[model samples]
Target: MTANETIHPTAPATEIDASCKLPLLALLVGASIWLVIGSVLAMIAAIKFHAPDFLGACPLLTYGRVAAAANDALVYGFCLPASLAVIIWVFARLSQTVYALPLVPVVAAHIWHLGVFVGIASILLGNSTGFAWLEFPRGGSILILVAFVLIAIPTAATFGFRRDRTLYPSHWFLLAALLWFPWSYASANIFLVSMPVRGVAQGVIDLWFGNNLLFVWFSLVGLGVAFYFLPKLTGRPLYSYFYAQYVFWTLVLFGTWCGIPAGSPFPAWIPTLSNFAGYLLIVPVLGVLIITVKTLAGAPVTSSSDPTVAYFIAGLIAFIISGITLHLVAHNDQLARITEFTWFGQAQTQLQIFGFLAMILFGALYYILPRVLGFDFIFPKVTRAHFWFNLLGSVALVIPLAIAGYEQGSHAYNLDAALPALRVSSMGLLLILIGNLLFAGNVLAMFLSWKITLVKSIFSAVTSPLKAVEVKS
Candidate 1:
């Protein structure tokens, strides 16, 4: 057998881990790098939200471009890759099989980053297509599609090669995610950008794409991670595991139809149906909450100082809140009018993207990275700081923005409530920036620590042979 095949051959799980280590590291490191870039741009965008003239001098840093660039970087660069890394790792573990060609994911990771860079650069250079999430130009979008398909194909192949054919909930969710993204993304690009939809139809398609990619693609992976970790970390089997099927089905089926803008120019029934679907989403959202609480109820894992618990707990709660917000917002026209085109809507997106999805990824990384690196975390101290910084920062952004929305809406554009809201949100953006920096720093520190350890081992091996020969002489 080749040396590669023998890698931790005695343990099936270790072999899978060994096979995935390099790809996981590469994807995760790229994700962290993009996190810093996104956070910087996000801060800039948040500043411009109220100030508007903060970077007025620079065309490249215009509010539209900067905000769009930040959104793309966070969604495509950081969140997508980070989520993909977790999906890949969890899928492999569930399959109970080692990768036959690990290089597939490593190469795909590089190409994916390249595509994200291209998309962000295109947006900055005034080439944005002006679609919400499908802003990437044709070239960047195509690159992402191709790269994603490369990974998607392998994901399906891996399923066929699994040692365990009985699927877990995580497996089901991952499979759905693998299928959903490419379809939704390609359809959006085609209808919104490439072929071009006319009038309100374009808006409808864009909303459809954005909502699916979030509620379906991102949510699937995030919940898959949550479901896997909640049980695994607590050393308990998932309570009501059967209900997970209901959660997954409801999300994919109902969640897809729920995002039609409340005031969309479409037929009244369309919007009404969407509102009904939004209300139906309560089932799965509550299911996830119940499952998580029951799984971790009375478990000592919650009390641990690992920082992962903080992220997990925060992410799960935020998800519930975000979902509840969506459900009611759709049913209430008055509330929708208040929120539509307001910072309150943005706040909810942040809660879902940053507070729930990104936090889940953060927790997963805290657990996954150490295992992939084959070492316990060397600098565990700053992780707690990382959690607090991000948590507080996210709160600062969400709460004030929601208030700002209310102030602007309730007061008929009066600046009374907007004033304090802007100030506090700006401060929140700064905290978010700091948290991203700390996360990047920790990832780098861990990588460097691993490299140094590897180098010392190699040096000691070389010197030990020389010393033995000299002693023999």
Candidate 2:
């Protein structure tokens, strides 16, 4: 094929990137609102750990309910939709096609947001299933699932009908994640809700679903965004396309198995399989880290000046650290000592979800929003502040929790020492709340700026013709 034909098999009919602008904005806005709500719930839950009597009067804000609501809000409400938006955009760009059936995703986004709202409300009302991430009731879960399918269909079609035949690394990650989530989600719901798994198997299913949700869905989306943006932003090609393939396949093959060891009260071999899989994951994790370093070897690391680059790099490091931590904690020795029924598990969750996945989303938004909206950030300082607060807040949140977890685990036989550790972790939660407040503030500022600019433009457009007529008269 000629070069021209290879590059442009089919010219785009419309600006593919701009087609989903409204939907993307809506998703981001909804996600930001949920981020704040989740932060508040998290703070309340954290406080209750140390000061059980603080909000003891309100049953709705009880520790268990609030914690479940917080997790639901962050995972389903904020991260899921935000990641979907990013993936959709990436798919559209790579396919060189406008988002087919654009209104479907827009409507689906609203429904998904409503579903999350109702789901959180259900949890707060004491209707929680007590499952890890599958806390949403069956009805709510099905609603979100249907809405997700609506969104995913068009994305899949875009991939299928792409202008280019060869796929990028990001494309593979995006496609795999989008496909994996629905199956995993449906299976979890079916096992946990529709046809209940027997005693020990229920826990196994829950752990499997929850961990896969993290590794396969959230982590994959983060890595996909990193693959697309890191090289683009730095004006460099990936260090090794071959290594990228290795990273993708390894994650796909091994990611699901790593979650099996999460204290499934099953037979010994089950945990052994999980531990071995977790150890094997180091190969891909190290490959990703090496690729990142080599790709940005000479590139100046300016996360401070460029929030997107900064967050991406921070997330990459977090991913590596989380991987190593997962491997170590999965070991039989460490699992027996540190993991079961301790804050250490929570620490790992926060590190992976917030430090790694959410950070990448933050960076993706920083880079994507302006281009999609056709404007620069109105308040650059707010963006920078958001980054710093998040960085510091995540560090504060994870480190204290890790320390507290170690202490709690070491003294598992002692209850008195655990209380003090809980208090220390609560302080970290306070920092996280503060950081989330900063993020909310930044998002609000951006929205207000956009609204103000839009109103001014409309006003000018309306009056311009009248002024022209007046000058003519």
Candidate 1 residue spans exceeding 4 A from truth:
1-11, 414-416, 451-473
Task: Judge candidate 2 against the unseen true structure and give its global Cα lDDT, from 0 to 1.
Answer: 0.80
> Each model's TM-score?
0.92, 0.91
- List, residue by residue over 1-473, the lDDT tens digit for candidate 1: 11222344334766777777877877878889999999899888877756769988989999999989998898899888888888877777766677556788889888899999999999999999999989899989998888788777766776678765667788888888888899889988988878887888888788888888766677888888888877766666777668888888898888889788666798788888888899888988898888888877877764453558668778888888888888888778898887777778778878878888998898998888877777776667777787888899999988998888888878776766677897798787788778888888888888888788889999999777554335554
Model 1 TM: 0.92
| Top of the candidates by TM-score | 1
Candidate models: Cα lDDT each: 0.81, 0.80
Q: Could you give candidate 2's per-residue lDDT for residues 357-464 as a string of tens digits?
A: 888988888777776766777665666677777777778778777776777777764545566766776666666666667666666677778778889999999877
* Number of the top-ranking candidate, with lDDT as the measure: 1
lDDT of 1 at 263: 63
